[model samples]
Target: MTDHLILRPSGEFAGPVDEHTLVLGIETSCDETAAALVLGGYDVASSVVSTQVDIHAQYGGVVPEIASRAHLDMLNPIIARAIVEAGVPDSRIDAIACTIGPGLIGALLVGVSAAKSLALAWDVPFIGVHHHEAHLYAAFLEDPTLEFPLVVLLVSGGHTMLIEMQDHGRYKLLGRTIDDAAGEAFDKVARFLGLGYPGGPAIDREAVHGNPEAIHFPRAMMHEGLDVSFSGLKTSVMNHVRKHPDVSSEDVAASFQAAVVDVLVTKARRAAQQVGAKGLVLAGGVAANSLLREQFLDACVVDGIHGFLPSREMCTDNAAMIAAAGWHRLRSDGPTSLDCGAFPNLKIPGLT
Candidate 1:
């Protein structure tokens, strides 16, 4: 395969060309190999994702090496498909964006390398997007009118935190997990119960048939600051399973999920109040949890705050959100240097 793939712009479709710039986004932060063409940043033209769920299912969790290899194999085809579906030629892409950090280094490099190669070939701007920041911007993709000075709850497999967003690229971290993230805890607890890989969904489905209050799982840091601790909770679930061998897995899943939701919702509510936020935004993989979304919305209503939740598709790893964030960054700061490399612990620059 050639290092650069080229396509001619199709002139047949007479869409509104001057209204928005078309950007191609790539994301391989973890197990999902994704590419998307976004219009004016917010409007998704086409999004293609190749998931490694089945590949990692047997292992009960993602294997970093396998994920990176899968991205290398699938990234090209996915990008081609996104371009085709968008009906936009490669030459029409105004800029290219890729997630640069706070993820598996191997997986991130595959995307970053591809993005840099494409930018060089197309002679277009290359924007490096932070993984977590893209999650926050996912809400903006659906709600373009969403105002700033909002409280963002970012809960994924690797991260769990509350951020006060004052403006685009300006963030103040309010709280974070001291140990395992909410999703990580779910996966660990799911394994303890033999629930299977991708614990979040498995637990969610089973919890529907079980009693959330049947077992009392601890909700750490509930009365303290914005920080959370799920390691203790995970251990509690393990001890419960070990002591009560006959305890129903469904009840364990329900109770564990409830505990996590309780902490997340409480912290988000408190952060919003403290910051006087105009709205509360939920993003990242854990935000896809049914219980969490329901509880968050209810909490928002009780606290008299507007709640913004991206669709399930947007909640998970994807390139569209990266494109949306990159669009704004490109406009404000231009493109990053071609020498920019992947950052495993990349944080928003202005955030503390």
Candidate 2:
């Protein structure tokens, strides 16, 4: 548990919340039950995540009912640990932030209910955060000086999209997945290859020792504007495995990973060039992929664009980024009413 606690204090709090203004962030948007104490917006006092990987591993993916139940059981302890680890009293927190959408509604409700209750009990504001928006804010958590006019590639198990961020709270959707997301495709292909659950890491580890070009996997959406298609690529992998019963899993994994990386890099770079973006930011679970990270950095260098990525810990679902984004929203727009509800398809406003 201690190993999962990423407590990095950024010296001092500087954003909307200061040392005196602390914010508690709760995130139960998915299989992870997370809580964080953030001073100001970027300064993380303590961040704790109770992952349901073990529970969901057998099922090959997250079961919404199981995930929600686990969150119900783990959220209180996680939140308590975060506050205790941060050395702050409940009364010290000025606001409570919770992920409110673009995720499993049952899981989201647990966090939102807790956050609203905490806010009411503590007499503080309650802020509802967009899950994907919070992922974008993760980049800012590590790099406070990172600027806007950037392109953000949000790739995760559930989402894949290229967003043009001109300023805070402003976004333009450039492209998205027509069917399966990149990470989802990775998981499905890994399952077809007889790899274990949570395929990203497993495939990544195996790909390290295999030949990426041994099997030529198709790269989707090379010329289809910014939007990508991964369903065909996944089907291709499945077909290859079925036809070549004796094919090496390592080679397939490497080839598949390479295909995904190639398409992601091409589209991301295209989006950046189209918008004349000064920086490129990658966020979400798939952003933690080693190959993706290396390839993204290489592309940024080739294009003379700055690249921003959060620490591996921040790349996944965590509440610190939610708090960071929420702090800004709280200061700028005030708190959300208790009537606000969770939204599974909550789209980030201003995106087309």
The clash tally of candidate 2 reads 1
Candidate 1 on 49-101: residue-level lDDT in tens?
88999999999899999999999999999999999999977889988989988
Which 10-residue window in model 2 sums to the lowest lDDT? 1-10
Error of 1 at 9 (Å): 27
Candidate 2, residues 1-352: lDDT per residue as tens digits? 1211111222223335444568899999999999998887889999999899999999999999999999999999999999999997787888888998879999999999999899789777788888888888888888888777989999999999999989887899999999999889989987888788898898999899989999998887697799999999999988998899898999999999999999999999999999999899999999999999999999999989999867889989999999988876666556777666788878785465
Which run of 10 residues does model 1 get worst, by summed lDDT? 1-10
Please identify model 2 stretches exceeding 4 Å from their true place: 1-20
Q: How far is candidate 1 from the true structure (C-alpha RMSD, Å)?
A: 5.7
Candidate 2 Cα lDDT to native? 0.87
Candidate 1 stretches greater than 4 Å from native: 1-19
